[model samples]
Target chain A: MSAKEITVALVGNPNTGKSTLFNALTGLRQKVGNYPGVTVARKSGRCDCGDGLIVELVDLPGLYSLAAASPDEQVVTDVLLGSLEGSQQPDAIVVVLDATNLLRNLFLASQLAELNLPLALVLNQADVAHEHGLKIDTQLLSQRLGGVPVVLTSAWKGEGIASVRRAIAEVLNKKTKLARLTWPAQVESGLETIVRAVQADTGRAPSMADAQRILFSSDAHTSNRLGWKLSQRETVVRQARDQVRAAGFNPLAAEPLIHYAHLRKVLDGVTSGGAGKQGNAAALDRVLLHRVMGPILFTGIMLGLFASVFWLAKFPMQWIQSGVDFLKSVAAPALAGTPMLQSLVTDGIIAGVGAFLAFLPQILILFLFVGILEDSGYMARAAFIMDRLFSWCGLNGKSFVPLLSGFACAIPGLLSTRTIEDPKARLATAFAVPFMSCSARFPIYALMCAAFIGPLYGPGWESVVMVGMHCVGLIFAVPTAFVLTRFILKVKPQPFVLELPRYQMPKPRDVLWRMWQNAAEFISKAGTVIFAITIIIWALCYFPRDAQMAEKIRAAEPALSTHELQARTQAAMIEQSWMGRFGKAVQPVFDPCGFDWKITVGVLASFPAREVIVSTLGVTYSIGKGAEADSQHLRQAMQEAKWLSGPRTGAPIFSLAAVLALMVFFALCSQCGPTIATLAQETGGWKWAAASFFYMTILAWIMAVVVYQTVIRIL
Target chain B: MDWLIIGAIVGSAAGWLIARAIKGFQARRKGGCAGGCGCADKIQPPKK
Candidate 1:
């Protein structure tokens, strides 16, 4: 809003390093994922473009053309045409192009040239172009595009950034707009008639670019944006199409055909290069993308990633556990007088937070590997491999990223469904995304595996169980998607067209940043939502303390050891508490799954978040003073737990069947509140979200019972 | 006195959590993200 400030928009094709350049120029650490569609919305930041000139730089979503096809692309088209409400008409445009692929990249630039905005062309990825032996003549390119400023930049390497900043400053100050392309008389006349018709209909004249968009768009997206209905403008639009047809072009294809023709001439001698050595990448793709070998490699990579997360994070998890125990030891005596206060701080806050934080190391490691895979261009190949499997279920390769993102969290995964253009496909993918075993569920698996599976079987088997638990949801998700897309939704199959970026070394800085950010987010949630839930659960399990419970226990077992007596008293009080009564009431329903009242309580309390079960168990099982109430202790407590009542009284509660059943339930159940809310928003109503919830819960319960019953008999 | 203090502490924690839950429910009702996962923050409204 300042007179001295000018807004410049950064627009480019997907995967052209526009975000990287935006980060470099503005000094903002906007996430820079190596894949396309990472940025789904416009992000703006301020930069001092020298001479005391403050530039407000807006980074728009990457699009191939103004003829937008998806919502994400429509955002860019709307912003560029100044039609998006509350968005400023940019004072200038910065067209960021990939230096290695000038011909294709220039097509978009050519369309922007027609907008008559002050323009600067940034030939980004200069280093890659140079390595590929590409030589672009900036001088000739500038002259060909009406002497607009052109600068070469390797954004990731911070090379030529100063030149880019200077070029932007020059364009803003001089108001040097790029020369517009002259169209053939037939096309020009057709566009003019459409413009006149629009003005007459709305009593307002539209810019020529808007007129062109309305005349040539394959759909009614542009017309809708102009607030003109098809009934109002169908005749003029048809007349314009007739003129375009007479000009020897199809109305739908005219814009690209004309723009490319102009671009071909404009770049006649402005650059030269063979498309670099794809030899290395092509050879890797042979095995990585092979029908048989690719899936094998993907499975191997995922197994190794999970195993590494477990093995590498073991030490840090122990350290955190120790820290938790130490804190409890220090606080127990300090709040000893107020038994309730001691219980709240030690059993509720510390135990819950510690149990969640213990898994932080594993979560961080998982994020690190995910970031590396995304940056190394292997994710696209993974999606390519998955396309075959997904196709049978009517989902395409585009759903792979959203599903993969679900492994980290489901909210962003649901948001990323915007990239899938087919409404049925998008809806089905969103419905299945919550079944992807997000990191929140990892704590449950880790606790279960480490406590029961690892100690009993061995670490190697533990790793396999860990991997299998991660896959349990995915295994169910495929058929769930199949049912939704093929039977219920009857979604038409869409071809998966993905451009695989050239493989490169993963940048350690970006990878580490992603890991740190995700880890911090995990910690933040633990301190807030998980913390609050734990306190409430603790209160539910702790209050209405029977004043004579300890006396009664001592009278019932007069010869018991001091530790034993205290443990009995604590157990009795908890059993008589509010949560305990509710758990007992629900225990019969889960009895077939081999879950006792305490396990049932954990399951029921964790509906808000799957991770809360770990903390809930931590609080539920807290008995002795200054007990080692970390995950390790919680695991020990679970192992020692026995069926207190029922036909199977005094039997060990956490049998192999029970552990596997619990893990399976958490894997398949739609337990996270945020995920359910996101599903409702993404699917456009609460109907599908509610269906997903009830269906997944039912399936999980049935599957859990089957696992428990079958495993118990086998054992 | 200790019992009263414990009651107050527990009551305050429960109150804060309920308020947060209500706020989250209202946000989801309004078609906004439920807030913990950082999606709501990343999505900024278009500038005027």
Candidate 2:
């Protein structure tokens, strides 16, 4: 630890603007959302407090109390006590309180007062309180809290941030500790007993705050942390609860009752007026959260967002395609003498990159809508709506956040399962999270829709198909979770408790920043992973050049043009190449799913990451080809593809059934390597990961085959 | 000569990709996010 650096922990209840304030203090773009559980891990950044003093700010997960009901809450409890491994006790604490709802927020602030650590109270959302016509007397509150510094802040607007920094510096300089509340003598005695018992068990006396936590918490999280034997801890806890009963108080209800009573007196006259008349939020929620209308509105919003993505991104996609074609045209002539180089540059790199990049605008637009949804506070309501559906399946509303996050990527979504208190529910949610149709699967759906569905059935059907593909995974995921929770895990139903934040207009800067970040990430993957995969696929499809194959084709068809002879030779060579042979060997397995050898090869090559399928198809179709210009685009190449063997020989390979089947397979398959590994870590074994992989793979195959056969029969 | 050059470029790409995949697998096995989704850095444990 540097002499000039002091660590301050930011603690608050969920949706109290703790993360927003953390971002403001550190100037780092930590993920901030209008809902709770958005931040499930500890994040820290340094702030220059101006005067050669650097403050290391640790942003802990949001929790209602220090009872540690969930894994994320345990992190906060562990960090505050300096018991978390590799972390020191914070030098000071900044307790963020929702200024408009101080009475509820002060419950957490009251508990922190007993820690005897230097503290500052940030009445965040001050702007909201002001707009609500609520007035807080900071000086009175500070005086009541034993001279601790108090500052008002509206973090999202960057209002009063400088005052917050000054308050932090002042609290540290003055070493101002919050005034501790007086507990009932009986409760105090019970706490003393637990404190002594803990000291005897662990050979160290615990702080009063820790003693209170152990005595009052219904869960064994505190004793478990102390490494106490279950039998011993239970006996000690029972004895302490008996003491509380002697004072006519239930041990479970005693802490909140005592704290609230004391806080009511201390905060008397510190706040005046209320937001009054329930405001616009209440009026809006009446409609948005209405039983019948909420779900219908949600469906409509989802459809509209996806339709906009397809309709809006079409122009940019065409521009990118044209640019790629131009580049290929210029490079083809320059390297005409070197056929291999020409193919590698024009067919492998440019085509592969272009195919992937054309979907960038779609990905960006989708993220922009998601960002607005998240920032507007509608995500919580959506979760509230989903809870009714999830409860029957043995999961709760908390699982919805992680499931929603999975649409962005499964890694963080799996990690966010820490917020679910029920072990069985968490595991079930983690198992189903990978099936949320992540953004990596978006390009495949977009390409299939654009190449076939759009042109055939118009943009309306294209948009519907795009939305349907996104829903395919969720449609399957719910049933999987139901079976796991009911038949295997037998999870008990848990209540969904969520505090909905006020609805606010989406911040344009944040939304655009999110879009830009996601777009850059997509571009980076295209340059690296997609680039490498394309080169390898191109090589595999272009090797063992046979000059006699062209001659044989020319001799067999005397009327063939030179271009036709070259195209025939290239196709035959690809069928004979290493990847071609491998794909053919595996093609039988996917034949029932309406997949040709080329599609099978692309699917196999994308096992490491799903998005590589686009690049793989690009390289497979473009290598060793002449500049026909018409077939340069990936969509054109796919549309022109035909089956070379079997009873369906000479028929178009990508029928509507086949295209839909391909999209279904990608949507359901557990193909992402990192997602599988994350599942292993979260579930505490590789067995669960293995089961998920095999189960999803078989399920995807069966579903694809079913779609293919049913659709083909109908057609 | 063009065949040799193409083979070298392809082989090098294959070799590099193989090494990267192996490294990523090992990292993921140890509970690190190698998802290449730009979240690994953000999701890390608190600094020592």
Candidate 3:
């Protein structure tokens, strides 16, 4: 292969603007994917070297060391070591170092130099470094590090970025000499002995790169995978440690690790700055991450997100509604002669699918807020604040991000758990993720809220109740996690060590691309599972309808107008349908929870997914009109619906107690199929998925029953 | 007009099938020992 197509791996610590640099260089020329053999995703991009050369840049996940305690760090090991199949070892390694915190950032660079690869060090965030008045003699630093080239880069302002590209190009073009670590005499001897032992034992020479990979893979599984059989590996590491201690180089004990101490000493000698002070950014962090005010600020942020989803989306939703209405009108006269054909064409396909599609604006709005928080670097801070609360539930603060993301869709949220270093914590986060109120639950909540809460309180209360319902799910979910962790599954908790990335403006192209990707996934879902279910539901309520009985009903209700008689006939027809019978059969089970046969029917149909509950009510109340087809009018109709027989006390059947019980059930239930699939994938087995489903279903049923019985007794 | 439904479904299915097929080809092109040798590809690594 030509030198111009050389692969370059980018390695750095988190919050170092590594992603910013990637976007700057690639500029819409990137592909997002998972690394082979792991669920952790790999983002790669191609950038031109201002020559005929194309630099294929692979961005490795952030890590403090090669000690592969997390799935993410393991990826760093895999790529740098060239163990991953189908990927050639990177021809050059670019270590992105944060200039503001050069001491700590340089530790990884020092480690990378030991591998003796073609290396280029990019001093990222140079603008921040300069503002703090830090002056570094780059030539001296380079000479001390065996002449590795260094480029000062400010990724955000697009400053000195061209220098980084040129540095990588120079390294690939073989114009730059390779860099190697000038380890202390003792440490160097220890590594050389270990390398020889590995080669002798395995009957093959250990590549210097392979030696680095083994040292980083300290986790139990990775240690086994790398075939660490020499038993002498540990002895060699201890010997190296003894040498470092013997040097009388007692740096800060545990406060700064030994590698960091060495790095800090080297860095400070070559660089100088006045005591760094806050440059206005600290003021923002004070309010955003403050103990007393952070939660309140976060609440305001969430309120804005929810309000935008409901209010700002109104215009586009109406536009889509009118578009569907136009399709209906156009189809009506064209298929007049065949009533069955007309209903199937307009109602089954368009109306059923259209109702679900109308929620696209709402989903897009949700993504907009998510993108904003992510771009601002506030997401990491939010996760940090949540750590204290998570610790109480035997989970680390990192668990909060996955659960918060679950609100959008559980699949991607669950996929994100790879970032959590602890296996037990990752699994716990995955198990509790489905309990967070997802967008799928919005349809159910909107229907019930309109029917019960909206009219009972003001419109403002809709937002309040929506937020309150989410809070209820969140509050209950953690305790449930605590109980699960303590009694059902127990494991040691991992330490909370998170990197709060610096604040930078999110790239608009990335945000828009993410929004489009999410929208496409939602549309794909609507076409497959949602579309099939809608058709099945229409078939369920429509088949076995009687023309003879409809005529008889029309004759008997002669006083009623045509529209009224037609509506009554449809209701009569549905009451005699198979679905109505099935609802009645399951009525006894739900009687304790105060659900009538009609509500029971809705619940049964909602098994495929919870959002169908609204559409089910739409069809049941509309009689044979197939409630799943109408989205907007369904809520109003549900509010105006009455039980066949009035309450025993002559009150309306859908009492406040019944409404509360239903809400509790929805809050506790795991009713989404995609969530089940996601759980299965994350858990690596169906056992956890099945267990999650059964437990949540049983819990919801019990809570609903207790709520109804307690309320009935008090009344 | 109803054929639009047919067309859309066909188009989406074909697109999905093509995507899936491409993924399969890519996986095979790499040529691994087992089904899961592609695990590393699915992982999101840090961008350089």
Candidate 4:
């Protein structure tokens, strides 16, 4: 390939603005995907090198070092070591170092410099560095690295893109004059001996960087890339480690000391004036990380986030609800001639599906606040404050991110456990994640709360109840995690370590983009999973249509009051229907929990997903005597729902006690099919998923029974 | 006329839903997060 088409890889630590620099260099010119055979995101962009030249720039995942501990770090190692399939070794490397945190950023740079490849350095976030009173001497710093080209750029503000491009273009074809980082004399000699033998055995030249990676990594991919036998590699590495230790300095610990010592020399006097920013940061951290105030502030922020989901979304939610009602009204008139058809169209299609879609606004609003916290770097602080609470459960603070993500959707939340590092803690997080009240549960909570709580207690109390219902899962997470970690998994927990990023102003475009993406995903899932469930439920209730029941009601219409006749006829029609019979069969089991046969049927039908409960209820009531396709009508029917004939005859079924029981059931229920599938996939076996499903369902049932019996006795 | 419109609506909706389910199943089989999971393109294949 021509030098213009040479592939250059961009590497950096997390939050170093490497991605922002990549975007600045290759605006509107990137293709995003996963690396072959692994799930790590691979982002490649075509960058124009300012003259008839263009280079393909691939931005690899952020990392702290070359060590491959997690799958994400594995991809970075594969790419740098040329072990990844379907990808050529990068012809050039550009390391983006955060100028504000040069001391740490230089650690990765120093590691990469050992590789014999063409390389350039971009001191990104230079403006931020200047604002913090750190002035970098670029020429001196570059000269220290044997005259490698260095460019100062502020990628966030669109400054110095051209200079970075030029620097990369200059080194696109030339090989770096690679220097081996000096270790203790004995360890250095041992590395040389291993490198020579590896070259002699495979007849492939090996750099000291190659030897270091092979020794540190036990991943098969790394071994395969180095062309070393796994057993032989393991034995040789152990031997070398022992030899280096015997020579005086600790073997494994000596390399970092040597690299950092050299970096200290090179970076000397290259930057100055950090005391002001450090003092400012320390002052802020004192309050934000306060023992007394930190937890309270975290709780307040969480309360604000959840509150916005209900408050800011109210107008848009109402607009959506009105549209659903309109659809039902139009369809009702259009299908008036066919009662069965009319019921199915209005009740099944419109009301059932409409209720789920109406909550789309709240989902987007939830993600908006989340995106702000994440992008502004406050998310780490949230976890930091929650560490004390998590530690008691044998999990550390790192597990909190996954738990928080469960609010959006349990699938993604469960998937994010990869960052927890400790397998025991990660699995424990997965086990407890389902209790975190995912967005799917929000539809059930929202519809139920607004229909009952909003009217009786008003919106203020409605929001409080909504947020409280959401927290039910969070309230139980600690105990659930403790049980799984101590008794179930029987594993010890690892210490947690997290780096808090410097807080910065969040970019609006990024936040809006994230919101739009989340909305699209929610909308897409609604059309398939939610829509399919609505149709199935609508069909179930519409079937075994009893025309005779209607005729009997008409015959008694003159003798009986209209409301009584309508109620009796509707009750008779449902009793003979398939679902009503099924509900009756299941009713005895649910008696203690305050649910009658009809509610039991709704619960059973919603097994595929939790959000289906709203739609199922919509379908059920629409088929009953007081069938109304709108929200107000359904709420009215629920309020009037009564036992047909018993000691509790003529008593409303959905009483205050019953409603609370049902809320408790759903708050703790493992009802979503997607969560089951995801948990199974995440835990790598059906055992944990089955266990999670079992415990949550049993817990939900027991909680509902407790709530109902206690409330009944008090009343 | 009502039958024709109803038939068309049911047929098309079923077709669309089936097509989407098939597409989603295929995506899941390709070794990543399921489509309903927000992390479909981002998460690794099923872990051990």
Candidate 5:
């Protein structure tokens, strides 16, 4: 299997460690896409280099230079000038830098050594640059640069990653020349007649670092991504900016004054010492950046990360709810001799993909506490302690890391509001980080807090009503980010600057590879969007095929009571199919919240995700009693769901005021469907995801008719 | 056998509605997201 490979890439700058040396050279393999039409992220990974060769790597995103101005630095300057589309070019180039910010990471390794290519460097906090006393000789910075290979790594003391894989396999097995540097005879006599008029109008040669950056990069989209010769490359880049301003330089500051005067003669005696004051990251950023104990220690670390995702997913959500009810009672009597293969194997693939993979231990313990609060930098000091409450909502602190990644989902909190530069505070932090509560509303707030608020409020007020219904999306994401950035996206409030890095100690394999890459993208969308919305709500409640309500429930089953003949033949095959006649023709638009047509067909088949309404109420109450979801027989058929007529006739339909009006209609709705197709692709518009799904479905039906008429008038 | 168990539940609900209409025609030809949320980067393409 030797179809040979090389690629390389891994550039750096932002909190260098270049994704901990591409997760210490591709650990759990790797992938993470993007960079085509550009929301940037890219990632990639492969790494064999244990000789049979096969490196790949990629990584990219973090920029600092190669003069790219955003669209994630024009996909890291069109994938390091291989010119991006379906990428390839990167045959070498490691870069990585940051030995305690070595001269602004050597101005992006001197603009990636004038982009000639086959580079290597690394440096990476060589033990926080020898714990600040700094030394960094690396064989006199690789013999004053010409023979590149620098290394001296410390990706947090995993020391010199085998001298950065034998200096990227000796800069991909040698023979790469051009290290000339010491330029500036007014930028080499203004790039020698625009590098010989871009090598006599592009017959090759023009890469004197793309003829000294198209003579002073006035960034005409990086001179049409350096293809050149548009009208003899803008009349030889305006006659080499009038001969580099008649040799006195400043052809727009002659490429950062001749790359910091040839990095001050190759950093003199190749860097020596004198650093000191890291006084324990400024005395732990003085009380984690305190101004009155930093918003009370960032609201006691976000109420101990949402009360330890319901007290550490209560014994692994009861051992993944008794291993999805012992694989639905061992596929119920081996598909009990077919009632459409026992309703497609215990209600369409074991209660709609095992009730969304029993919230994979509360999504890997809330992505292992947001991957150790974003790898120990205390999530940018919780966006510097929620930048004074996201600056009274005109947003700042870079819209607090996409409103703290909408608690873990608003489509990566609307693609991390592309790190908020301010298209009206990134569309008012992507229309207020989908009002937060994400881990797909943690199993619809853990199966309505364990079959209706933890056995009548026990597990300590069922984790304080599951951290106040996951703070109903941070209490309506702070007055909907202050009335959508103060009167619908007006936006002027920018000031956020943050930084706060130094707090190292996080690597438990980068917090279990970011909690198994966000709990394997929430258990691979429980096999494709919760197994195709739990088999189209188990084929709209198992078709219009009632078979005479299974022969008057097997001739009124021996005076009923196999739990009332499996609850009156699963409530007369859910009041005769088509999802109970479209949940009784939208049961008077969910009749003031006390929903019935089985909680309005599990909130109309969980509009494409909020944990597919607990496996569509475990496929309308255990179809053939295979016990659809977290069984205790579908929580005693939702605690004997009743109310067949008006004025709450026979009581029960999960009472406690219809399970706190179905957890405040799933903590204020707009029932998912990929968070309204990622708010119509991050607000270009389906009129702001149809005004955020008709203002959160009329604020989840007026807060579930004021929490089910103020808790049925306080009981 | 009960019409091959109603032809394997109508061929598993017609292969989950033709893979959800070929995943909403590949998220409307990449106007993006059908990768049900952890987007895995590169979205943008809609603004013309």
Candidate 6:
């Protein structure tokens, strides 16, 4: 066992647990970035294969072929040929084939073998294969495919992984000769003629194998690399077409998808299952994809998911809040006499950290549901059901995955937009993704629900109201996308052609691992970014205190008891602080939205993020740092608060109409800082970020005004 | 108001410098972008 290393590229069809396998092998040695010249992320990691051999694994984006039609596919082709500038050629390629769909998986595998690269065939999900009563003769399959070693693996059960790893090491160490595809005679002759023509046109030399691939699958990058104009390509393609015809083959025929026919033959002979009838996957698909039942099932799934998020997050939210409060309480006694230290500890750090901590439950619950759906292979079914709806809204079906995931956070959702092949659809999905009513906006919805809607409506009705607010965000996104498509953006919609994979019970280990990873990421990210913003927000709301005004308010609070005294002191400080004055200055702007100066302060505070609205409201109503406290007392206080000037004068500033309007506005607005930052990174410019902000803010203002004006008139 | 304006100016300058430094680092890491290679050379066959 020498201490040696191998470079292996893991290739597979999308949703085949390629990532899960890569994560298992590489652990923490992963580095991710966009592939050169495209927005598709490239994930590479290194693993120490037992016996001191280091295996650097590159997990290429799952593509159906080496016949590169899209950027993701082109990436696979580029790395395999050692054409990508910053990347080295893989020493051996590990083709991960789904045991269930051996025919489809072998299409790309057979194509890769033709490139003369060392290859190992890994038939993954053997456990699933066995359960479904399928059998594979690995020896026969390997011998049929030029004697390449075939390893059967159940990535879930950790069965046969060591064999797969050993196969990869053997291929790399032995430099095993790859078995080339046996192309039909007619196709081979046509490819040869095109290769000769391409060679004669350019003086530089390329391998016959390389030239063949370039003719069929070369992309914009490849065309540029080969120094071939469209005219030249067209001439070559015409010659190839003529050759095919002269040999009595139809150029346009879909049958004999050339390499696929051979792969299918290999699959039919080697694998056995679902030969006579459809299996469990087909049975589940019957109802899940049924025209009428599909939508109903989707609706049920979505309701169940949202219900879980709402209920499951409550306990964690309370725990996080209590933890923050306890920390602040512990620090209070140490800094009693020091005013600046006291404010910095309790107001800046504690308040800011608490605001972020409260979102843990929402992030966890949302990812939990997403994990279950994705792992069970139901996400594709969901996309299939919603494709027509999304297409009608001028978005592609691929946009639905990211948008649904946006409920947890928009950053990853925006990243997931890479699945949308069409550039126009990708941008549109990114633009509209922020309107999916992310967890950051949950605090605003909760506050309005508790303050105005919850009591009058009851608990179940409040849940509906909360869900309705999310619906408002989603409802607004479609029309906005439609308008943007027609006027501002104007990218043609890409056709939706999503594949639904077979369903399996989500592996509990994978689900729990995902939850732990996401929760840790959420807490860590919140600690840094949100913590900094919270401190800035505290500073904005504190300081520049009117010395005389503070004294005047303190004198007025003397008659109050100890608890009341603390409450009054907190209020007086806020009223005399810089934030109060700023709120007063902007109060006129918020008047039409039916907000007074205090609510105006909350709105301003929420611009960095929407969830701060809850804490802002909590502080404004003197409900203490805790929102779980007496709701009635907070509501009464909010109801009794008066405005400096209004037509109705002294009327409750936040009537039902006003509260509803605020919720509607927050629902539609792109106020999350991370979303804006991601937009800048994804689009690679501030123009899109600024444009997104401008459009969302304007839309929010208009919608809020409309809701308030119409409702106030009715009342 | 004066201090607020000054703070805004400082923040803008700081953000710009950070952005510039990151760009410089990326440029160095990528080593001059995607296409500056000759992997796609075409071969000429011998005269028959």
**Per-residue C-alpha lDDT of model 4 across residues A254-299, encoded as one tens digit per residue:** 6566678888888899887764466666777788889889887876
> Residue A184, candidate 6: how far off, in angstroms?
3.2
Writing each residue's lDDT as its tens digit, candidate 6 over A544-600 gives 655565356558765666666555556566656677778888988877888777788
- Among all windows of 10 consecutive residues in model 1 chain A, the one with the lowest summed lDDT is A623-632
Which of the two, 3 or 5, has more DockQ?
Answer: 3
Clashes of each: 0, 0, 33, 0, 1, 4
Candidate 3: RMSD over Cα atoms? 5.6
TM-score of chain A of each: 0.96, 0.97, 0.86, 0.88, 0.35, 0.88
Which candidate has the top score in DockQ? Answer: 2
Better of 2 and 4 by DockQ: 2
Q: Give all TM-scores, in the order shown.
A: 0.95, 0.97, 0.83, 0.88, 0.35, 0.84
Provide per-model DockQ scores: 0.57, 0.63, 0.13, 0.29, 0.11, 0.04
lDDT of each: 0.84, 0.87, 0.67, 0.74, 0.70, 0.67
Interface RMSD, prediction 4: 5.7
Candidate 5, B-chain TM? 0.38
Which candidate leads in TM-score?
2
**Over 4 Å off in model 4, which ranges?**
A1-7, A19-57, A85-88, A158-171, A174-184, A197-207, A214-239, A246-248, A337-341, A554-558, A562-575, A625-637, A645-647, B1-19, B41-48
- 3 against 5, candidate with superior lDDT: 5
Greater-lDDT candidate between 2 and 6:
2
Summarize candidate 5's per-residue lDDT along A191-224 as a digit string, tens digits.
8887776667666665666666677776666556
TM-score ranking of the models: 2, 1, 4, 6, 3, 5
Count of clashing pairs, candidate 1? 0
- Residue by residue across B1-48, what tens digits does model 4's lDDT show? 645765565566677767766765676565565646656554444221
lDDT score for candidate 6 against the true structure? 0.67
lDDT of 3 at A400: 69
Q: Rank the candidates by lDDT, best first.
A: 2, 1, 4, 5, 3, 6
